[model samples]
Target: MASLPNRKIAAAVVREDAAHRQRLLDRAFALAFKGLVYAQIWEDPVVDMEALAIAPGHRVATIASGGCNVFSYLTDDPAEIVAVDLNTAHVALNNLKRVAILHLPDYAHFRRFFADADDAANIADYRTFVAPHLDETSRRYWEGRDLVGRRRINGFARGLYKRGLLGGFIGLAHLVARLHRIDLGEFLAAKTVEEQRAIFDSKFAPFFDRKLIRWITDQRSSLFGLGIPPAQYDALADGKPMADVLRARLEKLACDFPLDDNYFAWQAFGRGYGKGVAAPLPPYLQEVNYAAVKARAERVTMLHANMTDMLAASDAASFDRYVFLDAQDWMSDAQLAALWAEVTRTARAGARVLFRTAAEPSLLPGRLPDALLDRWEYRAEESRDYTRRDRSAIYGGVHLYTLKAD
Candidate 1:
């Protein structure tokens, strides 16, 4: 079969060389990304909302990763949200989620399908309620056979949280920990951040020092499951050993936030969200925000296309908010300039752009032209604060920029 347009876009951004080794690695990463990558997005939507300052009547444009943040943004009642992605699976996932919210009988049914995410009854629910309303393209994707010949929608019945590329990576990490006689689950048992720190020091911290583990992490291909391309891996490493960087980031994830409220930690250590009703969830998944999200679900537009292309086709000054979700790290300088040119042209007065970086510094300064770069005022201090507070703990920095007054 010919490559999908979205997949082709992914190739264009990722395949940066023709050398045999480099070409092989790039092809492998693209293939891994072709299917579902993030069953749940790794970025913290709470931080995104706060930095974006999403207000009623704002037009928001974002990259649709796992569709978690897109759904979470609905609670803010934006006038419109255009979620564009170069992953067909993510596009289908986003469409499936919005349709589920619109057609599922109630919040209970919705919660059971997504939050619990492991019961076989979810298949019946999908068939009876969600599948009918889902766009035909998405329906085909969900109903399609996987490499193992099982239907993709069956993921909900078999621990949806444990199915995608990120999920598989986490599972492998857990297995590696098991080999080291460390149970990552011990961290999740902590009742306080103090206890979380203690557990990490005792059980998890030492695992990173093992020669075998360090060697595995040193390989660029080892990180493909986490969606880190070669260029992104270099940025993330920033001259430090990959093992050291991962350990520090994992420490933040394990100890910086309370166990009961940090869903990112839960996903990291527990392999899924906690089952309790009070377990932290993305805003859209919380019962308190259910009505608002459902009511605003229709406002979201899911597109399987490049984010820059989406902006290029949009009217000037049409969007007041943009979220790129670390995708700029994958772009060449020319690609970054092209993307920002569209962003600058399409942004409304006082518009805000939010994104994360694999490294500590914003990637735009020397890359984009001085003329275009000067149009936006970088929120340097606030971005550092946002990076500190971001619960995801995976990214090195979270940057925000607002368009300067014309």
Candidate 2:
């Protein structure tokens, strides 16, 4: 038998710097990984899978969340991908998955890499097929196994990481309610679809507008774990004293799409692991990505720096597609312009740039001048349809754009 191999660190662990990860997660919102501290993912875009009809050699850059859509997008087989994120843990996970897909030998090994709980065979598989390819930092990262001794990757198998800050917060609230003889999670996890509706209407509906819940959620400190900064907390809390937008978002989580097909709902309330056969999956994670997914692990350059900084690092007329993925909502006028200048410079003329926001309106209109924003044609109808059909989402909307004809 061969010895376990040392892991390789791809750029996916690009933001492994402690200070950078701290600024994003511990400070932004009190989010955790494997019940530790992953970044907050509230109001994240429901990535437009339909819009991801990749050309033969499209180079795409996307935000690396837990790395779901990155794999989803790969199902279309882009030429390359640049997945940037301020969160190191997320980057690490992306690298890990990409490597797993390439190294795991087959789909079953891939399933064991992410969805298999902490079984002896699973751990052994990690040591054999998976661990050898992981970079040193990532190897160490998974070895720590958190305080719970549950390997972080296996947490995905255990359906833990999918439960983001919002998911955990929902769980905490459900627990609080459970103490008072209310079982919010249980009621939502009804065996039948109709019973689930009854629970949503009778049990979960009132909590959306609860004053105490609003008060706690509105506090920046209270949301520290969710990784929202003081400013973002203020923005998300809406202008009123209570959390109106939050209530709406939560209501959407409960009622937007039927829970049967929506994986986000499973993570939020059903506490399910969407790790079965690739059939019931987002586009990126399907079997199409299995064979070639790891090949692009190194191709994508994950960075903690702003998109503008990333643009400065690249050359002109380079990327065929630039996917902003809602990062522009955090930009200032100068920042937006600077980022756009780089995007436009590196753009391959007809290259497309896409993004999303917290509301129906485009954040770029006032922030970015007309000429800069006009370079890309907004696919409003397509964005709307994608947003509506986004199944693995707890958020309300999505947006898309295509760069103008050269």
Highest TM-score: which candidate? 1
| C-alpha TM-scores of all predictions | 0.98, 0.79
> Each candidate's lDDT (Cα)?
0.90, 0.58
Best by lDDT: 1
Cα displacement (angstroms), candidate 2, residue 268, comes to 0.3
lDDT of 1 by residue, 251-355 (tens): 999888888779999888888889979999988899999999999999999998888889999999999999999999988888899999999999999899999
Which residue runs does candidate 2 get wrong by more than 4 Å?
A: 1-47, 116-120, 145-159, 162-170, 187-195, 240-242, 274-279, 287-305, 392-396
In angstroms, give how far residue 405 of model 2 lies from its true place: 2.8
Q: Which residue runs of candidate 1 sit more than 4 Å off their true CA positions?
A: 15-20
Give the per-residue lDDT digits (tens) of candidate 2, residues 43-107.
22335545655676888767666666666566566777787765556666666777677776777
